[model samples]
Target: MEFSGCWRNILSVAIAVVLLSLAPPLAHTARAQSQAPASSTSNENDIRAATVLFYAAFNSALHGDLAPMSAVWSHRPDVTSLSAAGGHAKGWNEVYAGFQNIARLYPGGNIEQRDMTIVAGKDMGYSVCIETGQLRSSEGPMVKFNQRATNIFRLEGGTWKLIHHHADSNLNEADVSASR
Candidate 1:
């Protein structure tokens, strides 16, 4: 990753860590704060839709399909991601490669975000949430996956494109290991 991309990834992960430390009632807070003027609401709704697509693609990626992932991510040079499965990627190509690796390491599984808090600006937005589910590990054991993630998106050509994703393994779940 470039220096700027590294910094953005760090900041995004730090924000997610802080959010994870907070109590679990922020869903309502997020909804209330997202209420705004018509234009802002439209943008927020668009962002939410992008998030939905992201997760759908995310689950698909886990099962060895990367085509859906292409639709939600920006084909940019600055995108970066640090996966909970233990790898770092910089730029769109590298990021997609990382997902390909994930598809290889995790051939089957499901992951879904919870208590996501969305913050949308005019051109950029981010989401902080917990990813919980079961993933069949590379060793063929289904493991509980409790992760804290932060996803950053950019408004590109009137659509929200995911520009960065940082996922950290949270071992709060009993006997949970790295999903890799």
Candidate 2:
């Protein structure tokens, strides 16, 4: 009985925290949706720019080169990233540091984007991508994973800069190796 009560309390708290964290973005989204123009040519261009950013960022991340990633980012404090490894790194400084560590650890890494789809709003856009690649590590055969990713971008000034990025690995037990 005590264990059940404890579990329930923990679950309730977790849900509350998640909802709280989501509140700001949910509100921002609501505002954007209500105010932004629907189906504009600039929106299409924003999507194309965002797509380029995605490819460049992934390429930089794979090479462990911060230069490419930094080029696409806004270089603002609000920039954030969610990694497939369940790690959260916020801001350009911290993000760069994290990637630097990764580069040190895995010198020869490659990332491939597959089945990528892009959608855009007036000043916001996102891409659905499947990333499959290998990280060359000192340990064994290296680490490889296939992930379906959604990357969010915001139009900062005239340039499309990455604002919020999220990636989730498929983790399918079946041989996703063939897709690579």
Candidate 3:
């Protein structure tokens, strides 16, 4: 009877020791599972807000205002922009210069983004959208444009900033009008 009691106590202690040893990893896994949905929702919200900011900045650029556009961009050396007006621009200075030229030429416009899909990761995201806009040229003629555009963003200092913009000007007036 004495030997049996001692063995039972030993078994209980061994089990407790094993459980305690496994507790950290188990707790971490449970915490991660509980937080996963919240984290995903927060990331989605951030991505949407960033996309809205991007459109606002694009509109500001369309209106020939560089301040907002400047604010939205990452301004890093790796930043890049490619558009009909700017051809292909790389680096902050080159991209800014391209925007300057685009602003000068396009002046103001009403742009509608359709079929936009945004995917966000830990610190980066990419969006693809169909941009249809009518731009009033500096000379006062309205030029309609339809382009497939993709934009890449990076999270910097807790805000999403545009890192790359690539747009194609393949669609003509007829194509844009037809889509409308």
Q: Pick the candidate with the highest lDDT.
A: 1
Q: Please, what are the lDDT tens digits per residue for candidate 2 over residues 1-180?
A: 355888999989999999999999999999877766556556766766676666667667767567877778777888787777567889888766766776676777677677667778767787777777777775757787688777778888888887767778755655255445
Return the lDDT, model 1, position 95: 93
Query: Which is superior by lDDT, 1 or 3?
Result: 1
Instruction: Tell me the spans in candidate 2 whose CA falls farther than 4 Å from its real position.
Output: 1-42, 173-180
- Name the 10 consecutive residues with the lowest summed lDDT in model 3: 171-180
**lDDT values, one for every candidate:** 0.83, 0.73, 0.82
Comparing 2 and 3 by lDDT, which wins? 3
User: What's the CA error at residue 129 for candidate 3, in Å?
Assistant: 0.9
Q: On a 0 to 1 TM-score scale, where does candidate 1 land against the true structure?
A: 0.73
Q: What is the TM-score of each candidate against the true structure?
A: 0.73, 0.65, 0.72
As a whole number from 0 to 100, the lDDT of residue 100 in candidate 2 is 72
The parts of candidate 1 lying over 4 Å away from their true place are 1-36, 171-180
Clashing residue pairs in candidate 1 are none
**Model 2: per-residue Cα lDDT at residue 167:** 73
Per-residue lDDT of model 3, residues 4-71, tens digit only: 88899998999999999999999999998898778667766777677677778878888867898889
Give the per-residue lDDT digits (tens) of candidate 1, residues 1-180. 456988999999999999887746687777667765566767777777788789999899988889999999999999999988677799999999898888888778898887677888889988887788888868888887688889999999988999999889765644233332
